[model samples]
Target: MATGPNGSVLVLTNPHDVTTDVVLRILADRQVPVVRLDPGTDLHTSAALTATYRTGDQRGTLRTPSRELDLTEVRSVWTRRPSPFEGPPGLGEQERRFAASQSLWGAGGILASLPGAHYVNHPWNNRAAEYKPAQLAAAQRSGLLVPGTLITNDPDQAREFATQQTGGVVYKPLWNTPYKADGQAQQVWVREVRPHEITAAVAACPHLFQAKVEKAFDVRLTAVGNRLFAVRIDSPDLDWRQRQSLMECTSIAVPDRVARSVSAYLSISRLAFGAFDFAVTPTGDWYFFECNPNGQWAWQPDSITDSIAHAVADQLENGPEA
Candidate 1:
């Protein structure tokens, strides 16, 4: 690793993140110094971090393989999908647990407290906005159209809610939890739920049920600071992510009202970047679904990717707007 000067960007993410790769390329092109760290792989293993607080003075340093970062000198920090710290190996279970907790809250606290560092959606804010119910509430409060939603562990309630929707309802997981069935990893996808299908299994855990939107297409709006990039997606499946290869996507204009609401939502959530999903009805009404503060975007069209990379680079280089 090479040392970076004062006021460089710090990127916390996994090595496989193509989004980070694209952003790094853009930052490099502009001669911006960046220090990338993967907490899961480097922290406590190959990297070193120290934080000291005394007499109203706070200081910290993070030494990565290629560079040493003065926490206070970080101009921007991109908290993208960095894996959890696993602590040192060869320790007993309880010892390892204690060490991991300290690493998370101690070292993590120092990074989170970096003065003068602009976090592109701080980790705490990202965790707060991840709640589906909270996201829907925020969207609705921002004047965005949101589908009637129900979260419960009662099968009867689930069935009744599904029955009330004229277009029927869909079952979506509150969180996309990775699971393994028959030794293969699987992810839950949004699927239409028939009234009868809402059985006792609903009682096993909480589920999110929403009135299905009769949509002609879907929209993915990526907001980078004040800039919004909207893309129209046409797909036959309810969850386009499942069959992404078959989906057709094109850059589209965001409605003035929708754009304003998106900006407001981001402002209210204190996010500098977000990927919002919406279902567009045939009548042109856009129904808000959810927003991923650290959503994937590099897989999108080249034009969209380049635009987002530029916006992120600009923010990291120039700091937040007044």
Candidate 2:
């Protein structure tokens, strides 16, 4: 089915992201008028936005819902890019600083006022999705095996948990953030641990510790609406990201149990999408690791692009009809 231009979509994102550009292109191809809202603008009121991006090309000088924006005409919003605001090309330091500050705070206020817009992935929902502990609990409730885990600031407790696991455990960062400077990338490595290492680990702060299960395979399950894209990620190293050249991934069917879990998890999370990571033990049992709510999908094989894109378009065009 083809779509006609009527309602508009406002995309609030960073200006420099290629992925954001691609999504905008997709939306444009569907004939939707897109309004780009930069992160660092004082956009709380619709008037501020109208003075900015809502202009001659798409819709000229027309009044939006508020002095700055007309929310009623906005059918959907995609929060694709997030970046610190930058001043227009040649502003001085003080003026630039002022603009950036207002933009940052205003963007928040504006987005908050848009309660009626259908958010593909809202900020609050995205924050909730990143909690690793919650994901593990949710996965287990859905009947997926989870490695024995511990969260504690106590050195003694940490050591005890490690000692009890059949094989020692692995320490994983709660968040998968990398520290980068000057374009030189230094990645944190995942390593096997002995019980004795807990003393130092506990000193760092509360750590997310898990039993290092011997895995036969790794699975990345990407969910879009009711459809599931399961891929088997195989590699020679403990951390696949460590050896991209040696890592291999192939499209694979989801086990019945996993498919069910994936569906249930998405429904419970109030999300239309998720990227789940799993470790399949030698015994063929799949253990849940975590799910990234704002996971990347373009890297997946092209075989599933039709369904994924279709699901997105359907949701945008026929949302909850506010």
Whole-model lDDT values for every prediction: 0.88, 0.70
Task: Give the worst 10-residue stretch by lDDT in candidate 2.
Answer: 55-64
> lDDT tens string, model 2, 295-322?
7666656665544555665556556321
Error of 1 at 24 (Å): 0.8
Query: Where is model 1 poorest over a 10-residue stretch in terms of lDDT?
Result: 1-10
- All candidates: TM-score: 0.96, 0.78
Model 1 spans with C-alpha error above 4 angstroms: 1-6
| Candidate 1 lDDT | 0.88
Q: How accurate is candidate 2 locally (lDDT)?
A: 0.70
